[model samples]
Target: MRAALAALLLAMPAAAQTGDLVATDALRVCADPANLPFSNDRGEGFENRIATLLARALDRKLDYVFFPQVQGFVRNTLRAGRCDLVMGTVAGDELMQNTNPYYHTTYVIAYRRDRPVPERLDDPAMKSLRLGAIARTPPIDLLLRNGLIGNARFFPLAVDTRHESPGADLMQAVADGELDAALVWGPIAGYQAKVKGLPIALRALPTEAGVARMDFFITMGIRAQEPEWRRRINTAIRDHQGEIDAILRDYGVPLLDAEGRLQPP
Candidate 1:
C-alpha cells in the first residue's frame, strides 16, 4: 500500500503538467472583430490566417478575443487577459513584449502616374500640391513635422466607413481626383491601387522619417513576463517564414526586400 501511494504522488505532478499543455489552452489571440484584411470574428483575414498557421505550427487551437481597435485594444484585450497574443503590433509599442519581425512593408509616396513624383514632401514644387493621408499614420506624422501642411488636404471621413476600413476609400478618393496624392498604409494602399489598375506610382521616400531603417517591420506580441510564450512565437516566426510570406502574398500585400523594393516572388 505504501509503495503504491508513493508512485501515485509522483505521477500527479506529471499528469497535471501534461494537462496544462492541451491545444485548447495553449493559444489565445486578440483581434479586432470588424477590422478587415487584418482580422475579424469570421477568421477570414490575413492576421487570422497567420494566427491559424501559428497555432497549427504550435500544435494548438486558437481562441479569439474580439474588441474595437480604438484606444483600448492593448489595455482591454491584452492587459485585461482577454487573450495571450496581439497580432500585427507596431515596433516599440510599450505595453507588450514584441518579437523579432518576420516581415516588412514600405511606406510609399503614391501619386497619379502623370504627375511628377515629388523628390520629398519638403521640395519647393510640392508646396501647392494637395495631398491626402490618414490622420495619424507615420507618413502623415512626418509631413506634419516637416511643416508640409500647406498643400496637405485632409480627406473628410465617411462617417460610416471610418471604422471598418478607411484606407480603401482614401486610396480610391485620390485616384478619382479627390486628392492629388495619398500617404497611406502600404499594404491596403498598394493592394487597392493594384486592384483598381489606377495608374498610380508608389515611390519610396529618399529618406523615410520616424523609422530609421528602410526595413521597418511589425511583429507578434505577447505579455511582458511571458518569455516562454514570446520564445515560442519568435521560433514559429523564424521557422515558418516561407509560409508567412505566402499568406501575405495571397492578400496582395507587398513584402519588401532588404533594399525596400517589393520582392519578385
Candidate 2:
C-alpha cells in the first residue's frame, strides 16, 4: 500500500547469512532509475509495473533502491543489503540465484515495415544494406563473419544507461533511413517501435546459430542463500504470468514461450 524510490541506501543487508536482504514488510526491488522499457524512477517501465503487481500480490508495500544497472549493480544494491529483488536478469547469471524464467526473448533485425524483411543475419540482401548493431553484442560476430561489419555501425555497448538510450538511438537511425536496418535486442527495438509508433518490423534471431548465442530467458534475481525467497518468487511468477505477459506486451516486449513460439499481442 506504500512505496519508496530512493537513490541512496534505505536498507542495509547483514554480513551474516540471515536473510537480511529479503524485506519482510515491503517488496523491495533493485532497479536502474533510468533504464527505460525495463525500469525507471518514474515507475513507467514494464518492470516497475510488474513489481507493483508482485507487491500487490504479496500484500506488501512496494519499495525500490534506484541505482544504475552498471558494473556494480548487484554488489551495491542486492548484494550490499539495500534491496531484495531484481526484476530482470539473464537466466544463469552466477552472481545471484534466479527464479524460474518469466519470459524469453532474442536479438532482432529491425527494419522499416516498408523494406524487405531480413529473416537472418546472413540474409543475402543484408550484405548491400547499411546495417547497425551494438559493439559487443552477438550480432557483431555474425556481422563480421558475413562480411557485413564493413557496412555496419557498431554503437558502444553497456554505456552509462542512466542517461543514455543507445538502443533507442540505433533503432531511430533505422526509422529515419540513416541505416537500412539494425540488429538490436528484441525488447529494445520492440519497445521503441511501439512507443513511438515507428513502422518497424522485428525478426527474431536464433539462440545458437553457431556464431554466438542470442536468445535469452530472463528471470528474477535474489541472493544465493535465499532458497525460500527464490521459491516464493517462482510461485509468484507462475501465478501472475498472465498479468506479467500483459504488462510486457503493453510495453512492446517481443516474447517467446518456453517452447519457442512467438507471443504476439
200-224, model 2: which lDDT tens digit per residue?
Answer: 9888866655688878899999898
lDDT of each: 0.73, 0.86
lDDT of 1 at 195: 48
Q: Where does candidate 2 clash, by residue pair? A: 13-81
TM-score of each: 0.79, 0.90
Query: Tens digits of per-residue lDDT for model 1 on 195-219?
Result: 4467676766434545434335889
**lDDT at position 193, candidate 2:** 88
Q: How big is the positional error of residue 32 in model 1, measured in Å on the Cα after superposition?
A: 1.0
Candidate 1, residue 147: Cα displacement in angstroms equals 5.0
Clashing pairs in 1: none
Which runs of model 1 end up more than 4 angstroms from their true locations? Answer: 1-26, 114-116, 144-147, 155-164, 195-199, 206-215, 259-265
